[model samples]
Target: MSDDGRQPDDPLSRFLHGETGALVFVREVLTSVLAVALVGLLLFAVSGVWPPMVAVESGSMEPHMERGDLVFITEPDRFTPEFAHGDTGIVTYETGAAEAYTTFGEPGSVIVYHPPGSGGSPIIHRARFHVQEGENWVDRANPDYLPATSCEGVPACPAPYDGFITKGDANAEYDQVSGIAPVVKSEWVHGVARVRVPYLGYVRLVFSEAVLVQIDGGADGVVPAVGGERVSVTGSERTTTTGVVGSASPTLATGSAHGTPTATA
Candidate 1:
């Protein structure tokens, strides 16, 4: 033992108690920070084609995906859908196509993206079909649906759409009608949901105060501790900002390219 009778490697305890040498403590802290930053940069370098993960917020996906799930996302270029024919296990859709939209044991690809003009956070939903100027998207999933024939009845696009239309699995209307607008382009698209862990996100929610119980009159996010000190959450929708829930899945996501920055859920 040293003159202080402490192990040389116990930097954390020393730093916390203001007992370590100034240079030693600074070195230890910088070393830790740099190591973490390096790992993050490495993940970004490889998986930046699409964000590797997203936290589920709302119940829009229901039955299949639920709130408080951590969804592992894959790069659009590397994501493959299990179609009616068979599974390719490779990247299929790159840019939007005129026809032959793919599915994941359903009607559309579950996509994560940001709206062009809304300036909102990234949304995770299913991409039903890719449409050009005059193409008709007949929903096999919904047989009685009718096309708007004009932007008048559809979600107004920033420009004319040459991309895919998205929808929430549990929602009554498509994203366009749901106020998220219609026509997501190849550029706006980010990750596709691949695998999800059930309710594991509650741990994050608990610590981050994303999970809450109603307090007094207003619903506040707080966890009461032994001495009655609570981790309180206030004045924000952050409880739902980056949501986590349950869903079905096997592996994490695959990336098509690298360096793209995906937004928070």
Candidate 2:
């Protein structure tokens, strides 16, 4: 008999000593459930559906967001979609292909498209311009004329007086392939980038450039070739200009004349 008066080989004693399988099974089940819940929460945070996204690529938004930058993006909402011309943020698209055309910003993302003659899908660039009322304006690139009705059929088409265009500061011309009157709809915008965690976007930038190089077939030779894979440099920048929203007139600024200095948070 044990000192506590229980039998040395009692059923309860054996179970406590790992002789029974029920406890082990129960523990494994509980652990699995907890792990699944934790993963679900993580997905929600990173998807930008809750608040924002982390930067994963670099191109025109370089210097501002190097590879590995952590950007906090705000959830997309009706009120948040009204972008002030020149506001920068992360922009999310409804489709996987769309992600290729948008930039990740804290609380939002920016959309940039390819130039008229470039043959490829439109890409998202930093927000360099904004429209208020009916007049077109430029905020971060070269001065140019823009109309209010640019976004006529694109997703999240802002109602009369609630739309804006985005472009890369490094580009020479506006994106015409996405349509001359491409409008940014409220549904398409995620939110404005308010904070930036530098070096968090480095991985994203490397991945984006690598993918672009593969798509472009090593055009610039920036990407080195692997056994079966090839890499190249993709430097194409998309520009969006024109449009009106709110009460102020849109103005154009020269890209070469003035560049928006990179800001770090």
The C-alpha RMSD of each candidate to the native structure, in angstroms, is 10.8, 15.0
Error of 2 at 155 (Å): 19
Q: Candidate 1: list runs displaced more than 4 Å.
A: 1-35, 79-108, 138-141, 144-159, 202-265
Top candidate when judged by TM-score against the true structure: 1
Model 1 steric clash pairs: 56-243, 67-245, 68-244, 68-245, 69-244, 69-245, 74-253, 75-254
lDDT of 2 by residue, 33-137 (tens): 677456435634543332123332323344444323444433343223334223333233222123344334322244322223423222334443344444333
Instruction: Give a tens-digit lDDT track for model 1, residues 1-265.
Output: 4789865567565565554469667877777867755654564465453235454544556656655565566656554544411221222232223335644344445766665554423566666655665544443224322235444444443336576665655555666554444566767766566566566444444444334433233312211110000111111121222221111111111111000111122
Q: Name model 2 segments beyond 4 Å from true.
A: 1-52, 68-70, 76-124, 131-141, 144-162, 174-181, 199-265
Model 2: weakest 10-residue lDDT segment is 249-258
Worst-scoring 10-residue span by lDDT in model 1: 226-235
Q: Residue 156 CA error for candidate 2 (Å)?
A: 17
- Residue 222's C-alpha lDDT in candidate 2? 20
Report backbone clashes per prediction. Answer: 8, 55
RMSD of 2: 15.0
Cα displacement (Å) at residue 232, model 1: 20
